[model samples]
Target: MELVVYLAGQIHDDWREQLKQLAEQKGLPLVFKGPQEDHDRSDEIGEAIKGTQPSSIYRDHTASEFNNLRTRIWMNKADVVIAQFGEKYRQWNSAMDASIALATGKPLILIRPESLVHPLKELAQRAQCVVETPEQALEALAYVFE
Candidate 1:
């Protein structure tokens, strides 16, 4: 069966592409959804579309609400939620995605380096499995289907 998977968090890297390629290579039928890929565009889209707000906070709030709308809708539709955390950025959105997945009864796979384990223990406890690489995430996805 085809899977609707939500790929969340860490927009700076190419992890989503990597995961999608892995899925294709392994013959997994997955439809991936997530926030916008371009970090700058994601940040600026609100301003661009809505016109520049009087203050930065207002602009950001507007943008965040729009983003949350898209995310929440996709999250509800997802069969599995895979959130990846990278070393550089503080990915608050990733944590939120995981929590929503758990609350909504969708399986979750969290990907992050070992260095993050200690800080993310609570989040880890919520996941179906926590893995350190894209390959491991792919394996987790396969296991989910099985």
Candidate 2:
């Protein structure tokens, strides 16, 4: 059977595509899913489709809610969740996604550098697998989807 995998967080990088490619190369029966990857488009879709908001906060709120619709659905349907934390930014969304994955009993694999291990200790503890690279995350996927 084909497994649905949620590619969450750190959309700034190409990690999602990389992991999908790896899965394809391995002949794994997997389908990669995620919120919209286009940052500008994801942000603007709310205002574009539903009309503009009054202020920055309202605009962001609208956008967040719009994105959350897709995210929530995917999280529920996902057999596995790989949440990536990038080095430059505070990836709070990733942390949230990981928590949701655990709460929903979806197998979670977190990708973040060694530097974050201490700060994200609690979150890491709850995950099924934690790795530093997308390739390593792919390894976890291979094992699960194989």
Candidate 3:
């Protein structure tokens, strides 16, 4: 089964890169989306990540109500959703994704930033698991995919 992870776009570069590596390693598909950086940049970014290619691209971006609707539509087809809720918190987008994941009862993996930490010890108490390192992420991935 393939799981769709809702990644945080504003995340640290290293983290995002690590996530991509992890996805490839796990043979899982991932994608991230945001207000097109610009009309031109949007196409470039979208093509690079999504393209018309037959690859799984996870679209994780701050979404408005309408955007959230679109996200939900996409998410329903996913096996799971992994969201990185670092120090920065945008109530609408982050919470919206989390809530949807919760409502759908899909597995949710919450990744905290290495630098800025989360006060909540158990980020996702109900999440299949909460992880701190990339390696941990892989372990969690195994569980979700298996």
Candidate 4:
């Protein structure tokens, strides 16, 4: 079964890379359909246009819309959806994704750092497993994939 990791939190490059490594170590094919991945180049573009005319600034609304569409498509194809709710308190997007996963009948694995207070702890309860560590997250993944 293919696993698509839809990371839903502040896209800390190191954290994202860690999750990617985890998937690789597990030998699972992973797809990350996150806004951060889609907007990786946006910061550079924004910097380049900082001094340019407001009209000259590039605003790719279509890109974001398309990304959302792609995320839903990927969610449908995924065997499991791992919602990584990092220490940060961003809940709206991840919550929505979790809801979608539940609606689609896909197993949802919610992960958070043990030291942080998870804002969506309630929503996490609805998942197949709510893990506080990388090891626990991996275990949860193993159970679901099994």
Each prediction's number of clashing residue pairs: 0, 0, 9, 0
Off by over 4 Å in 1: none
lDDT of 3: 0.55
- TM-score per candidate, chains pooled: 0.93, 0.95, 0.58, 0.67
Q: Alpha carbon lDDT of residue 122, candidate 3?
A: 43
Clashing residue pairs, backbone N/CA/C < 3 A, model 2: none
Model 4 TM = 0.67
Query: Which residues of candidate 2, in runs, are more than 4 Å off?
Result: none
Candidate 1's displacement at residue 88, Å, is: 1.4
Candidate 4 lDDT over residue span 1-146, tens digit each: 56666655455445567767887888766676555454455434443444333342344443345456766877887777777666655556677788888888988877667654456667767888888765576666666566
In model 1, what are the clashing residue pairs, if there are any?
none
Per residue, candidate 3 scores C-alpha lDDT tens digits across 56-95 of 3332231223344556676676666666655654434445
Against the correct fold, how does model 1 do in TM-score? Answer: 0.93
Residues forming the 10-long window of minimal summed lDDT in candidate 4:
50-59
Pairwise TM-score winner, candidates 1 and 2: 2
Total backbone clashes of candidate 2, pairs 3 or more residues apart or in separate chains? 0
Instruction: Count residue pairs with overlapping backbones in model 1.
Output: 0
